[model samples]
Target: MYQRLITSRHFVPLLAGFGAMLCITALSSLGSAVQSSVWLMAPFGATMVILFGLPESPLAQPRNIIVGHLLTTAIGLSVATLVGVTPWTLGLAVGLAVSLMMLTNTTHPPAGANPLVVMLAGEHWDFLLMPVAAGAILIVVFGVLYHRVISGKQYPKRWF
Candidate 1:
């Protein structure tokens, strides 16, 4: 997975998408839905653009980005709700999210933070569906438009 993820075809678009997302987020002042103050969510959006939108590498394919993030959000939110908001709960939420994502075969690394963000923020749990899940969907939509329609790249090679 690491070898495939780091290849030139994957890395170049990943970086470009990351930069693009950052610029859009900054300009729009959406204030980053991710819990970490750092621009960590950028990579999640970037990965979607590279894999789902441009899809030069197998790992970057749309299935990996969309299914991966959906699984991550579901597991993360479920764990957060079950465990409640505490230090250990937060840890468990993130851990469960990661583990579930990996198990589900949709492992988008950056989404590991979603559970933690929901737990720490003490959100109403609906946050997972909105802003977090919604944001990801928006990112995917933007990537499709930018990489496919505009840039002439094929996105969502196969919709499962």
Candidate 2:
């Protein structure tokens, strides 16, 4: 049974977990060097799962990951700045983010937490550029490389 599990592709998830570990570690290292870069965001863990564990999903696409994080974070920053971080505004931000993601055809579920993260932290505009935009972009890039080199799989069925 143990040998069957090992050789029957049951360890793919474990392999993906290792990939996640490497990716996040690289991000964290860069984030430490770059003061403005916050590559270790909460939602990124979920992003890693989709990227490494299920890279074939549409949500794992580069466009989806980048645009979803950017759009959601923008909405969060806007709502937090203009409407404040009250309960209703928080809901409003997340709703708008989801709706906009659907409208833009970039529906990455993990990015949905951007509003809460932004509102709760009261992040400035730089947050959109650093962790939201840049971190997401690098994550996608890492996912692509990991899939090709380590997992021997195709990723991102589409680019746009």
Error of 1 at 139 (Å): 1.7
Q: Write the per-residue lDDT of candidate 1 for residues 1-160, one digit (tens) a residue.
A: 7445544586756656664655456424554544532322444654544454345554455556666666666666676667666778777777877787777776666666666655565656565555556556666666566655444556656544
**Relative to the unseen true structure, what is the C-alpha lDDT of residue 152 in candidate 1, on a scale of 0 to 100?**
51
Stretches > 4 Å off in candidate 1: 1-19, 22-54
lDDT of each: 0.58, 0.89
User: Candidate 1, overall lDDT?
Assistant: 0.58
Model 2: CA > 4 A from native: 1-7
Q: Give one digit per residue, the lDDT tens place, for model 2 in 24-88.
A: 99999998898855777899999988888888899999999999999999999999999789999
Give every collision pair in model 2. none
Q: Estimate TM-scores for all models.
A: 0.62, 0.92
lDDT for residue 84 in candidate 1, whole number 0-100: 60
